[model samples]
Target: MTRPIRFGHQARPTPDDDLDGVARRAEAAGFDVFLIADHVGHGPAPMVALAAAASVTTTIRLGTYVLNADMRNPVQLAWEATTLDQLSNGRFELGLGAGHTPQEWAATGIEFTSARARKAALAERIEIIGRLLDGDSVSVDGAYHRLVDASVPRSHQSRLPILVGGNGAALLGHAGSHADIIGLQGLGRTLADGHEHSVRWTTDHLDAQLGQVRAGAGERIADIEVNVLVQVVDITADAERSLAQVAEMIDDGTTTTDLARIPYVLIGTVDEIAEKVLHCRDHWGITYFAVRALDDFAPVIDRVRQLE
Candidate 1:
């Protein structure tokens, strides 16, 4: 099957930067989506920043790349997301995740919970948030969240697209069952000091993770949009050298060959990268890609647009 491809640019806006101009540039650069990351004390708030982007741009879709479920009440988050969808005139896609960063929890004075706890909490929120976004009155007596006779303003879209991002089996399984978009983030393993583990960068590991999502999705797999966040995009004449550098950065005993196979890193000339993206869509059913907002990625966006 030939799946349709969509490109999203993930923008990190500092307080000193021109937010409106950034959104306008993304729309001009042939991007289909503009996404913001949710982090405390690192960048602007995701939904608030997207609201600013929504006011300036007319066509590019605006969204949080993935909001941490541990941070907010589900009912309140549903209201805020629906409101943003209304403000953006149905151009909003909601992305939610089980919280992973320990530093963010420390910074916010929120208790850092185990991965299992976070995933379970996220599952509950997805249920409540999904219903609320659909304009359903909900009353849930759950361990993590409680909602009594709650309903949010209906989203402009009959059902706003929900993107659930994660790497673990349980979390991806939940995403497979509920989300419109399933973001295949590689295994998100972080050290105690907030350093990323290189194991998450391996190709074999990602394939295994996707298998779990497939199993959980079952018959609904054909209806779901699969997405990957491209961590490295190097368009250069010396593709092998770029791959080597990425392999070293990942440092998980991964070879250049293995790096080449991983869909999340695009390292090649425009033609080569474009061909690889199409190959990935054909083989793995991944057509939605999110890359960091950088000048280097412009040609790649143009190339992917041509494929459509």
Candidate 2:
């Protein structure tokens, strides 16, 4: 399906930044969604923070950029999702991922399992969470989770949107088959620190990933919306110069042309970046974009809308 272009801002609230004001500003700046990340080290709890954001904003949607599915049991997560959805007047978008960041588990004393194991667990969690949120009495005997007569309060939206995010063919394929939205970060293997990833920004890699999504979606392809998390949004006349440092940091032998082509990095003036936005939708079927900061991406939102 041809979807309308949408913009979302991820709020990384520090001690000095006011969360409510940040959300309000995101709405005023024309963001379609205001998102928070789920992390133990930083930021407020996503559900609680989004509830607070809901109280202040009337239009902007609230979402978890993604919650770590490994840490959350499906039943409790579904209940929290339902409450947040109701409180937000049905604006909640549930974003889930196979947990990355081994340190998160280490800090919490949760066993940090293998990536393959985590992905398998996430798939099961998604199944349970969806069934529960749909007001079904779910009973499952799975390897990672077991539930008997499990159900949650139905969300206000009847069918709340679920966004599945992360990198991996298995996970993305499953997301394609099941999720309302598939989030692509164009990332590869997690690096040594556990937080960063090897850049998989090349078209070849992305094509393979989308092929997986397409294969999984099959006839349901038209119903799913693809979202990209843009790592860098530089509104500048000198695109190459602006991206030079980023290129150095990448260290993946990716060329300047590759950088220009990658949807994960937007480095140009508002008009130029807006053109790229349309191109992404036309070429890759990606209609939704989320960036880290509101100010960096707000101008492109207006420009993209105007161009659209």
Per-model TM values vs. the true structure: 0.96, 0.98
TM-score of candidate 1 versus the correct structure, residues matched by position: 0.96
Model 1 lowest lDDT segment of ten: 192-201
List clashing residue pairs in candidate 1: none
Model 2 whole-model lDDT (C-alpha atoms):
0.90
Off by more than 4 A, model 2: none
Which numbered prediction scores highest in TM-score against the true structure? Answer: 2
Tens-place lDDT digits, model 2, residues 18-69: 9999999999999999999988878788889999999999999999989998
CA deviation > 4 Å runs, candidate 1: none
Cα error, residue 301 of model 2, in Å, equals 0.7
Q: What lDDT tens digits, residue by residue, belong to model 1 across residues 149-242? A: 9998999999899999887889888888888899876655766666464456676787887788888888998989999998888888899999
lDDT score for residue 251 of model 1:
69
